[model samples]
Target: METESVEYVKQTMEYSRKRAIRTKLVNFVINKIWKVPIFYSESRAEGISSVQSDTDFMFEADGIFTLSNEGQIGLKSDTSVVYVVMDTHEVHSGYTRIQIMEGDWNDLSEFASSGDGLRSLCKTFGNHNSKYLSNILVKQFWETRMKSVIPRQGLKNEISSHGPSTVIRYAADKDVVEVDTLICLRGEWPEVAKEWLERKRNFNWPTKELIEEIKAIGCNLVPIGHRLSHGKELELEWRISFSKAECLLIWSLNGTQTACIECMRLFFQVFISPKFPDLFSSYFIKTAMFWLIEETDSTFWQPLNILACLDRLLSKLITCVEEKCIQNFFIPKNNMLDAKAVESKELLDVLRIELTRHDVTGEEKWRMLIKEKLLQMDKNDIYYYHILINSLSVSRHFIYNSIRSSNIKDSKDMLMQGIQELKCCNDKDMFSDVCKQLQHELEAILSIVTFCESQSDSGTDRILSPNDTKWVEETLNKYTELSHSTGKLLLCTFYFYIERYQEALAITEDVQTRYTSQVVHYTFWNRSKTPRDDHYPQITPRPTLNETLKNYIALDVVLLPCLSRLFRATIQEKLYSRDALFIHPLFYAFFVRFHCFYRMQNAAECEAVLNKMQTFVAENMDVLKTTQDFNILHLGDSCHQLLKKHTESGNYFKKTIKSLLQKGEF
Candidate 1:
C-alpha cells in the first residue's frame, strides 16, 4: 500500500512537470513567436499589473485572432510550441513570417524515462549541457519577444587611450533610447566584444563607414603614424562616457610625411653612397629613391597588408639579391671584420633603437629588415657577401634558440628560411664555412628526430622524411652548379653520415668535378667508417679515381700497397687485373717518395715495404737494366727493403730474376 502511494506521488509530480513545461513552451510561441512585447515597470504606479506566471502579449500587422479551431499556424508536433507566419517590421519589410517549431518535449520525456538521452546530451555539450538543456524552455520566448528599435545619432567625442570602446552621452537632455557615434577606439579595449555588440545593435556607430573615411584620409592607417604624422607619440587626448583613454592621434601627414620622405632619400643617399657609390646604376638609384619614400609611409605594416607586401617585396628582392649585392645582405661569421659587417652592425643598432623606442619586438620586422638589406646589397661585392652570410647565420642561431627554448613549431619555417638563404651563398669557401656550421646543427636536430620517431604509434617519421628531403633539396640545389662545390661536397658528406645517403649521392655525383683526390679519399674513408655498414660497402667497390689524384703520388702509394696485399695470398689472384696491380705499385712508390722527399724517417711499416720492393726489383733488375730510363727510375728504400726481405727469406729473387732475364733477352 505504501509503495503504491509512493508510485502515485511520483506519477503526480511527473504529470505536473509535463503540464508546466507545455505551458511555458506555448507561452513562448504566443509571446516571442507572435512578436509580443511583455513590458515590466520598475515602478509600481499608473495602475500597472504585477506578474504571476510568464504571460503573452502580441503585436501583429493585422489584428490578433482568438483560436477557433480554424486559423492555420504551422505547429506539426504534439508539443505546445507553435509557428505563426506574419510580416515583421524590420529590415526591408517584405512578406516575412516567423516559423513556429516544436519544443523538445518528446526528447525530454524519453531522456527522463531512460536516462541515456541525458548522458548522450551531456557528452555532446560538455559543461554547456546543463545551461543549454535547462534554459531550452526560455530560448523560444526571447527569440519571439525581440523588437526592432530605431538608431539615434549621438555626439562625437575624442578620447586618448588604446581601448576599443568609446561612449559619448549625446543629447543627454532628450529622452533618447538609442545612439550611434563613431568612436575612435584602440584595439586593446577590455570590452571589445561588448562594444561590437553595441555597434551591431545601434548603441554604437558602425565601422563600415569609419573604415571608408580612414581610407579617404589620403594617409595610410597604422598602429602608429610615420614621422610626418604622429611619429609614435601621443598627440591628443579627449574624454567621453565610455572610457577616457580613447585618444585620437592627428597630424598633417602631407607636409610632415613629405618632409620625412625627403629625409629618408637623403639618408639612403649619403649612408650607402661612399661604399656602394658605383654599385647602383643611375636608373636603379632613382628607382631606389622612390621606393625608399614609398616604403617609409605606405601602410606596409598593417596586419592585412603586411604578408602581401612581404611576398611582393621578396619576389623583387630575390632577383636584386641574386644579381646585385647579395653579400651585403648576409653576415657570415668569418666576414664580421669586413666593411659590410660594419653596415650590418649599424642596421642591428637601428632595429634595436626602433624596438626600444616603440616597445615593439616583431619577428616580421626583423625578417623584413634582413630581406631589405639583402636586396640592397651588391652581389659582386665580397664584403657584402660575407656580411649576408654572417647575418643569416646570426638569424639562424637566434631562431634555433628561440624554437628550442619555447618548444614552438612555427620557427621551423623561419629557421628553414634562414637556411635557404644560406644555400644561396655561391662562394665555395664561404659556403663550406656555413655548411660546417649546419652539419653541427644537424647533430642536435637528428637526436630530436630520433626521439620523435621512436614513438610507437607516431606517423611523424613518414612526414619528417619527406620534409627533410625537401629541406635538403631546397638548401643544396642552388650551389650544385656554382663555385661552392667544396662546401656542398662536405655538406653531402655529413648528410650521408646522418644516413641521408641517397640525397648525398645525388648532390655529390653532380658536383664530382670539384672533388680532389684528397677529398675523394677523405670522403671514401669516412664512408668506410660509417655506422651504416650496408651503405658503406656499396660504395667500397667504387674506384676513388679523381683527376686530382694524377699528381698526388702519396695516395697512389698508399692505395697500391693495400690493393697488392689482396692479390698476393689469394688462390684466385689472376682474377685481379693488371690495373689493380698498376694502382698498388704506383701507390707504394708514391708514398715512399713522399716520405723521402719530405726527409721523414721510414717507419717500421715502410721498412717492411722497402724490403719487399727491393726483392721485387732485384729479381726484375735485368728487366730494368734492359729497359730505357732505368737510371731515371731511382729505386728507393722501399725497393731495397723488398729485395732484402726476399733475399733474407731465401726466395733469392727467383721468379723476378727469371722475368728480368727474359726481359734482358729482348
Candidate 2:
C-alpha cells in the first residue's frame, strides 16, 4: 500500500518527465532568469537536442520568484522544470533542456489518484484532444495546399517557405484520462496561431469551427540547415511528424490498414527491436510504411493485401539502409536515414540471414506470428508512444457553447460582436471572465494592427489608422482586474503609446525593486598546475561578495529606464538612505538632479545631473555587465561611448540640451 507520506524521489531527465519539466522550466526562466519583460514568442518550444542540461544542475536550484508591476508575486516555478528556447545567448532566446527545481512527485501522483483526479481519469475527451492537437498540424494543411499552388504561375515565391512540425509532446490519445500535453512543430506540426483578422462565426470565441480549420491545415517543418540551390543559398528543410497525413491516408484505406501498420510495429518491437535495439528502431519500419503508402494508390491497400503492405514496408527500410538514403516525402532533399545508416545496414543484413535460416521449407514463422497478434496489439504509433500527453483532455464546453451561441459570420462580424459584448458587460460578478474575453478580442485586433505595421516597415502597406491604434489601447487597458505580468506590461505600453507618460511611470514603479537569486559556487583544489574539483564552503549570503553587489547594480539598472529625470538627484541622495522603497539596498542612486534643474532652467542643477550620470556609469562599470534583462544589447560599447562623449563635451552639452528643449526634442 502507498503511504500518505510524500516521499520525494530524485528527478531525472527521462522521457516520462519531459513535458512536466519543460512547463516548470519555462516558468522559472521567464520569471527568474531571463526576466522576460516585454516581447513574447509562442513560436518557441521546438529546438535541436543540444539545449538540454544535466538533471542535477536544475535540481540543485532554488527557484526565484518574480513580482508583478504591482509588486505582488507573479509567476513562480517548481524545482522540476525544463525549458525550450531559441539560440540567443544569456540563454534568453532559448531554454535549457531539463531543469528540475522543486516538486513532490509522490504526493502529487497520489493526489492525482484521489477523488477529483480519479473522476477526471474516467471522462471521455476525444474531440477535445483532437481540437487542441490541431495547432501543430497547421503546416500539414499547407503542404497539400502548396502542392496545388506550385503548379500555378507566380505562386512559387509567394509560398516558397513553410514553417512548423508537430510538437507531439503536448498532445493526447482518446483514452488518456490525465491531461497530457501535446506540442507538435514543422518540429509543433499544427499549432494554428490565432489571426489578426478574426474568423467569421466563432471569431472571438473558441469554437469547433476553429478545430476543423486546424485539422485541415496546421503542420511543422524541419530545418536541415542551409545548402546551395542554384546560385543562392537555400535552406534545406524536412519534417519530423508522426504524420497526421499518414494516419488519415491509412484510415482512408478499405479495411485492416491500421491493423497492418500495427502488425509491422509489433514485429519490430517484439523481435527486430531486441536484436538491434538502437539501430532498427520501431519508427524505421513505420516510416517506410508511410512512404510506401504515399507512393501506392488506394487500390493497393486492402484487407487481403495487408501482408503485402507489411512486406513491402520492411523491404523499403532494408533498401533505405543499404543505400543510406530515406528521402522525406515532402522535402526530398532531407535524408532521414543518415544517422543510423551504417548500423541499419548491418542489422538488415543480419536479419535477412536469420529469416532465411528460420523460415525455410515454407515456414513463414515471423509473418504468421505478426498477423495472428495484430488484433490484440494496442495502437502503438510514434506520436502516441513518444509524446508526453495528459491522461485527460480538458473540457472546452464553455468555448464550444460560446461559439455556438454567437454564430459569428466572419472576421468583421466577430469584431463588431465583440465590441458590442464588451459594451454590454458591466456586471462585476463576471469581471474575470469578461476581462479574459476582452483580452482575446483585443489581441485579435492588435495582431491585425501589428500586421499592417510590419507590412509598412517592409514598404508593402501603409501604417494602421490612428483610430485602429486608439481602439487597441482602449481595449487592452479596459481590464482593471488584469493583474497578470504580461497584461500589466501591455497596460504600461498602452499608457506609453497614448502619451500618458505619468500613468506609464506610475505603472513602472512596482517593477523598480531589488531582486536576488541564490547561486551555488564551489572551490576547487589546484593539483599540479591544473585543478581538482571540490565544493566551496556554504555561506549565508553567498560564497562570493561580487555576485551580491552585482544583483544590487542589476536592479538599479532595470529601474533607471523608468526614472524621472527631475528627481534624479533625489534618488541619488536616497541611494545610501534607508528611506528608499526599492528592494536592493544599493539600487542605482545616480543623481539625476541635473535633469530637473535643466527643466527648471536652473543651470547649476542641470550640470549636476549630467555629471552624476557619468559618475554613476563609471562607478558601477564592474557590475554593469549583469544588466542583461534591460536588453541593452551592447551596453559595454554604448556606455563607453556615452561616458567619453559626456566627459569631453562637458560644458557644450548644456547648450546642446537647451537647443534640444527649444526645438521640442525633449
Best by TM-score: 2
Report lDDT (Cα) of residue 326, candidate 2.
66
TM-score for model 2? Answer: 0.27
Kindly report which residue stretches of model 1 are placed more than 4 angstroms away from their true locations once superposed.
1-395, 403-666
Q: What's model 2's overall lDDT?
A: 0.31
Estimated TM-score for each candidate: 0.17, 0.27
TM-score of model number 1:
0.17
Q: Write the per-residue lDDT of candidate 2 for residues 464-563, one digit (tens) a residue.
A: 4676566556655553223222233445544443445556545444433322122111111000011112212233543222232122112111121112
Q: What tens-digit string does per-residue lDDT give for candidate 1 at 1-666?
A: 233223322332332233233233222322332222221111011111111111122122122111112234333443432222221212111111121223343333222322443222221222332111211211222222221211112222211122211122212111211211121211112121223223332211223554234323211101111112221121111111111111001111222222222222232344333444433322232233223323344443232333333344333333333333322110111111233333454543443343243223333442433344333323222221222232222223222322321122333333444344435432332334434344334333333333323332464344435554455444444432222243344345335434554565455444433333322211100110112222222333332222112222111111111112111222013213211111122223322332332233444544544455455455544334432212212334223343344443223334444454465532
